[model samples]
Target: MVTADRRQGRRRADPPPRRRRLPESPPPPPRSARTWTWTWGTLLVVAALAVLLLGRTDVLPLVAQRGAAVVLTTLYGVALAVRTGGRPVISGALCLVLGVAGVALAEPILLSGLVVLTGVVSAVLGVMLTLPAATFPGVVREVLVAVVVAAAGALAIEGYAAEVSRERLAYVVLALSLAGALLLVFRLGAGLHGLGRRGSVILAAGLGAVTVTLAYTEALRRWASPGLLGAFESFVAQVDATLGGVPQPLAILLGFPALAWGVSMRARRRQGWWVCAFGVAATGPLAVALASVGLVTAGFSLLYSLLAGLVVGYGVIRLDQFLTGPRGRRARQLEAASAHRPEPRRTAPVL
Candidate 1:
């Protein structure tokens, strides 16, 4: 009777799940290297089609016609949704549509639209996923701060470019470097919090060594490059002459701290550190190109990536320890075994 009642309740609750039309069955899963081979091949095809579609159209004005970018991103979101169970695909689709819309409007409405959309989208997605997207109350403030720093970087880059008479390019770069580093460091703090004392110390030392060495290597590259700093310097000089305000935007964009900051803060250990390092390394070239229009951008790109990588690597390892702990897993197993065995009671000594 109970089983019958329960079945009836389930029937009432779901209403039979109605026979839904399903997507077509895919081919059997490929093994080993075939997996990557297939995935990459599919991606290339999709990408080619998307490019052909977006490229031939003169949709929005040039800068925003970055629809090809949007398509790639949207498709990638769909792909991630497949791998990560759909969170990113959903979130990214929302971001793409909204971002494109914001970019489409005329001025007085355009930039404002972009800013509002950016904040709203971030807040909404963060809530949907339980990520700390800075609460709605403080999100605007944070966005504003990010904007200020990015704008400052852009203005400074512009100043450097156009040969504005100022002894302050060094100061501007210094400020941005400090701000970006601090952004990364604060991000690392999350990882550190996850790591307790012992794990934290060991991982810190390891990450520190790695970050320092990487930074040094990048510094060496800057010194060794054929054009030296001059090649870099002149690149900015040319940008200034051509487009005045581009550098600051590029700098702000560059200073956005590697995405690995999230993973680095999550793991506080081996896997986390690796994820953070890999993400930053993967993005290094792009970041460099995005930060400046010329040579200096390349040098700083390598420099910032190395620094961020090292910082996140060190921090993630530390946190991983705290979250998983050294003895927690083993202790649980031992306890489980003990629970199954009868306790050996001891007699008290005759008193």
Candidate 2:
């Protein structure tokens, strides 16, 4: 090759660098399918078992009579523990120690603590999947599914073996719990938060706490007040007479959650005052009774229904916001007002 010579008095430029474009990456598949895979799989399995074994007396009475609940509980506990993958919370060492203590004690409190722990762990796992690859997100969902199934299965077994002086009340409580829980779970995937979740949760918690409180009070030999006692008698009469097919005190129970939800959504002043009024209305003269199926219990039933309505309404509004980006009401109103005004006309001078 000849040696290169430098240019003199002549401008020289370097050759332009070639630009190469990289191929664009394809968009990822939608995650709905993945989440559905686990949720559906779980629903299918549970549904199949329920359907197949539903009519069979063999499966019906077996668990209760045989203490199958304990087994189910153990299985559930283990499954959650596995799901957690022993992720540390607070402290790893502390978790291990407490977990071991809980195990060694086997007391009800300890066991209950463990159950709550597992739930917390499962939730954490779900939150964890919200980031990064979102890889195997369904795995965490499956684990939660497993937890609910196991807990319900075990509880059912326990309930069946449970001895209640009055089978009617026992069945009623169980039925209500089952119905409410079922409702909660059915809409679980719908992701109720703004109103749906908060409402439902409030309803569940408020009603649940009140019912438990009443039961405990009664257990402790507490007697109802004169008016309350009269209502109780009326409740007894209606139930015994078969006058109506209404759940007792359901409205009052329902009112708590609904009212709580309204307070959550609106300011403490505007909505809270009204909500408080209605709540007191439920608790006060039992005015909500008029809405109930039963003569005496309708007032409380109405109260609860009102609360549920509020919650559902609030939730719907919030969900709308989430789905369709938030917009100001004042801005929309102003735009509407402007639209009605005459359009501006341009004036041209003589050319």
Best by lDDT: 1
Candidate 1's residue-wise lDDT over 169-214, tens digit each? 2223333333333333334334456545754554455446435644
Q: lDDT of all predictions, in order shown?
A: 0.36, 0.35
**Sliding window of 10 residues with minimal summed lDDT for model 2:** 342-351
Superposition TM-score, candidate 1 onto the true structure: 0.32
Candidate 1 — which residues are off by over 4 angstroms? Answer: 1-64, 79-89, 106-194, 198-271, 274-291, 294-351
List all candidate RMSDs to the true structure. 18.0, 17.0
lDDT, candidate 2, residue 157? 30
lDDT of 2 by residue, 52-99 (tens): 234234455543322232332333333333333332233434444555
Q: Which stretches of candidate 2 lie over 4 Å from their true place?
A: 1-37, 44-59, 64-159, 164-221, 224-234, 237-245, 248-256, 259-351
